[model samples]
Target chain A: MPAGQAVPRGPRTSRFALRPDERRSLGFILPFVLIELALVAGPLALGFYYSFFKVEYFQLTSFRGLDNYWRVITSPMVLGSIGATAIFSIVALGLTLTVGMALAVHLERDSRWNVAVRAVALVPYVISMLVGSLLLRWIFSTDAGFMAVVLGPIGLGDHSVLANPGSAMAALVFNAVWRDSAFAMIVLLAGLKSIPPSLYDAARVDGAGAFYRFRRITLPLMRLSILIAVVRLLIHFVNVLTFSLILTGGGPNGATRTTGLALYELGFVEFKLGDANALAILVFLFNLILVAFNLLLFRERRRAP
Target chain B: MTIASSPVARPWRRRARSRSAINALINLVIAAFALAPILWGLSTSLKPTQDILVYPPQIVPERPTLEHYAMLFQTGIQTPIINSVIVSVGAVLLSLGIGAIAAYAIARLPFRGKTVLIFFIVALMSIPLPSLIVPTFTFLANVHLSNSLTGLILLYSAYQIPFVVWILYSYFLSLPIELENAALIDGYSRFQTLRKVVLPLSGPGLVASGLFVVTFAWNDFVVAVAMISSGESKTLPVAIYGYLGFYGRDWGPLTAAAIISILPVIAVFVFFQRYFLTGMTSGGTKS
Candidate 1:
């Protein structure tokens, strides 16, 4: 039907009733399903298959069962990227959660400043990561960077975050937290709000310490929210591919080389189709593992009575 | 009752006395630290090129100017604002239309494989875009859609449909069925009932889904990087990034570009933030 077409009221009125004779709805979704199957499902399956076969752009080239997998499983460069991605993700996740949780707790008190804090918390998320890194590039500049020379003057002044390996990673982690912590705070704040005030009042009357209340009550209650936040952070960290592409360009001697950047280098830049396919498969498997970790955590919560 | 009379009842008093002071101090510090970059960005956007780097950089600009903002549009390179607007608006329309229908179907109509369909959509959460890079690029190129705003809108619409569909389905599902029954007796067809009654009633969910589509399309960088290469067709994020590459150390124009680039996203977020927040939490906790 057209946007405003009037339908006959007698029989067609019941869209919810059995439309046993109708195929239109099936037609509506069929194309979408086929495209998903072809584009998304096919590629993922083919990717895994290519990992088993010696493959390049258009050729199976040859069957090298377990060979590409072996290379990926052993390459120090691949392992190193995994390590970098892990550290980047874990540190960012930890800080975002902790900071978000802290902020959420503070705002729950309903102070007037809560509005200011909440607004500030959300602003950073609106900044595009590409622009965000560009800004950070300026802020961390040794020559004219404001961050090193200004706020934390004596301690951080003179040190360039991009030049050093540990600090480089720290800079990336800091950037991720700054962008995503707002998101976490938003989600966790909702979780906090869902809990009845009566519960907190009862805890206070029972003489629960702040620590006791948070540990025994807040943490457990926020499990689903925390799980969602972690999962979201993990996926975004995987795909924050642009940062390494631009920020450091996996620089300081590959100190910041992310898995995605390496794939781009191999697949697009170098035209190393085989290596790129292998790298993509590895990242896919790693992501699957993280997703599984999240589902398991959520399921465990559900299974508890 | 004796337990309450015991020290247990006043335990919060002791804990609060010690921790309240400490908590206040620590959280203030953290909030300030977390906000430092944004504050710095705002400060720097206000500064002139020379003052931007003044050693021990001044918190307040010695002399602020709109020079950077003035310089933003002076560039010969195309701004992605138009592209961003088109793609985001197009995506919002398409996603909401398809999502509303799909959600209503799932919410009201009983069908085989309904549960499985919802599950399939939810499972998309696992497939990171990076893993889909090669296939996505290949597909777009093969179809002659790469580098086009239409293609970008389609990409976002495809990616966001599942998320928006699932949630809107639930949001619509929870509305009392009597509304539909009343519409039925009033001689409205199912389609009319949906457009006239159901859609209007789910205003908050529509805002939530539409805003999400808008932001995801607007702030996106990765797919834009993979798909678009031409200077003429780049989105704001890509345009600003490219601008930075050429205009390095030109703080005046760069800050101007950053501020302009993010204005739409910020506006959208501020306007419907509550709906977005509630939508997100509903999807997570309702399951």
Candidate 2:
């Protein structure tokens, strides 16, 4: 867009000579860069490097190719944890998005109570995972959580939700959704607010029903937001560590063990640094694939529109 | 204009009376479904453990008492509210310093791989952290960094900086550039431009990042539990985690500890008023 010829010229260092503002910029960036080099990037890169070698007392014993990756795949506990993580993620994602989107739409429609509800909705989100898990653990405890008491008339009874594998996983997902739904709602609400009001007027004039208009106009317009919500929820589900770790310790009998918990066990508890790093790299790649998949879905939706 | 809370703008409001009644019914159902857990959490926190174990249980506490709250304050479990304050404040202060400089660079300075650097900051959000815990632990182990308050601060800062940079960077980017240019024209140095003009104008971003850093570090349990083994260095979440193992599954005290942990985060939410409104809704642009 600049009035330059097609030939790519060198960066205009001569014209864009360093000014006092630029010097200030260097001063600002210097410390943060040093910290990152020493702390984050260093750990991450070395984390990968150490995985290949037998890391013992700051020394790499020897580079054992593929051994770490193989251990992650073949180890029963680790693989089981991965399977549990997958199940936990999928269940939580489905429940949160459905419930969260519904709540967002409800808030958008029920404007009278919107502020009160929105504040309450945000309560769980702001509360530390430590707190929420603790609260829910008490409320859903096998003998006397409030959920059982509330559902008692309906014969649900006061069984500890965590005692049952299905319910334990359900409880974990339940607590997570309760907290995370606010985020999904916020994203969707932003999207909903952005839609042109005229589209609703146009739909009404055409005598299209509310459901149909929502299906045709709102859903279509919400594509980007929904995609974002899904991606966010996906990231949350896979990477979530605190809730599962605190609530269940992977489970009563590994019923609720997830890949994340497995990584912690392998790396810290078992001291399998290489295996944990390999698993972590795999989780990252796995997440990358999910993100790519969501993008692909977004592109397809755009093309169809 | 402030978006008023009125049903007039909603599509459902235009329906007939009969249809409206049905719509209200559906809305109530959804609201109740969503509000159930909050109500549930409140109920159990008020109930005695013996009453808690009663199946086909009472919905409300028969004798509503502060016993659970009392239990939470019991020793071997409680994270002294002051400890939570220390870590959360430390997190906010340190992360702000680091994020401010890094954000300043990305926002103002023209360096190579600027886009790449931005991407790296954003990418930190999506990376599954479970994987990192292992390597992080091992790395921490080598440096004798494990089991220290300093280690927890360092790791939390690492996590918080990327986020702080991101929120602040966009805000800094959006501020009018002419102020910095004008300061330069007036012969004030870049440092002066930042100190006087850029930084002052970008208070909202700083406040927002401050809120985020504080909230995150306050809520964090994983790093605290992993890095620090000593009771003195152990923060609130770690203390709460220890409560479970220590008390041998006493939900009353555990729930109490959990509530105590959140008071600081709540205070933070209330304190950073303007930042809370503008900041949280500003999602990290990863999506």
Candidate 3:
């Protein structure tokens, strides 16, 4: 049926078209819009608002203005969490990017082995972070852990990584990269696919070595994808909570306590609402800065084109 | 034959063979790195209590046992699994229904503020969820929604709706507008057209988005930990964490519970393997 064949008779005559198209569209959309605003946008605004006030046991007590922010900024735990988060994000992001790029490059072609490895690699991504952390705990456990069994004969027996602060942090970083690199691989794989093969072919025809072609062609084309993956991985790493929570429980003197875990303790465990809210806002600002940086990279790429 | 006898061709063949060998080596490492932890967990899950603590642990148990699995089912793990299923499925249904409709409006209908709405969804996608937990907890408590599965479902749907809109919006855009226009010419209302014509075409999109929502809601810990403290509404992830605390030395049942927690997720991934990859990658960076 052609649209022009239907005459615009009285709008009220058609029972199905009782309302105007605009109204009907609005009706279809308003439910989602209203619920999303109330649940998502509303809470975000409330987080900002709550940062300025004191609340105890689910009741708002008084407005503290900047005191909460002042205390949170000066708090050692907050500063420590910042430092921890920085270390975790840098190490995790670097490893994930390296591993993910390698996987993408090797698995870019269509082969049975590549396909199987790709499928298996995604298992960790789908598994809950909590469960993934648990799996790592078992793998790294001191008593009969896989690592223990593998390393026992080499005089590195009974090693409990989670019992030591530095090693626990390493465990956290390892787990972060393990779960997230699959995501990075998928993103970079798409980037590799998007690059015109003709560019590589042209370089080959010019007698460029494989390494030269990769450096001159693949790296430049993959720059944006790398940036995107870095930002996303940074966000996940910086906000990492469950990995530490379920694995190390921030043990061995707060070794793996990222800012996210600190916030969890503040809000849920200690009920320090004002401080928690202030810290939440601070984390949100940091995330916004990262996202802004990502947008800048994107804008620069667009301008170059 | 002349080329085959040439020294250059001999070196080239050797190089090609070595390159493939290197590729094979890399593939082996990748598979081991990815599957080692999970496979270890599975091995431990099947091991008896005595074998789990033995020195020079065997990669494959000599006598595989289902005792730990029986123990897992007999314990409190069941509640968390049930809770996870309810919240995840509820989130999938809620987000798809509401998000698909909104995506349709954005894709097909020329409504005012449509661009702004799309931008809003994008911005919402970037909001760090952990930062919002404090206020969300407070808000939920005030509304008597705290510690409830319903509240968790609502929050999960809200968090997932942004990706739903982003992915489904693209899916709907790829569809020809003329189809909807043709339905309109047949005197079918927009809602009827969407219900009768558009939905059948959006099956793949729905499956993709639904799979993502299920994975997220099921895998989440930050939200569930913040919102629900009691076993009444605690999810699998949180419950499994509690198991770690309680059974710190009981690797047998603990690993078994961990396996049970992840079994459904692995099933979904294996069953919808293609959609999961496509949806997640596409959702990673919008075109």
Question: Who wins the DockQ comparison?
Answer: 3
List DockQ for all candidates. 0.30, 0.43, 0.53
How do all models score by TM-score?
0.84, 0.84, 0.91
**What pairs collide in candidate 2?**
A20-B190, A21-B190, A139-A145, A142-A160, A144-B52, B147-B227
**Which digits, one per residue and each the tens of the lDDT, describe model 2 over residues B173-267?**
89999988999899987667777888888877888888877777777776667676778777888887777788655665665566567766666
Interface RMSD of 1: 4.0
Highest lDDT, which number? Answer: 3
Position A111, candidate 1: lDDT: 70
Off by over 4 Å in 1: A1-35, A42-74, A110-112, A150-156, A194-206, A293-305, B1-31, B185-188, B282-287
The residue-level lDDT of candidate 3 at A136 comes to 88
Q: What are the runs in model 3 whose C-alpha is more than 4 Å off? A: A1-21, A152-155, A294-305, B1-15, B283-287
Model 3 chain A weakest 10-residue run by lDDT: A10-19
Residue B148 shift from truth in candidate 1, angstroms: 2.0
- Chain A TM per prediction: 0.81, 0.83, 0.87
RMSD of each: 6.1, 5.8, 4.7
Those runs of model 2 whose alpha carbons end farther than 4 Å from true positions after fitting are A1-27, A55-63, A109-112, A145-147, A150-159, A290-305, B1-80, B270-274, B281-287
DockQ rank order = 3, 2, 1
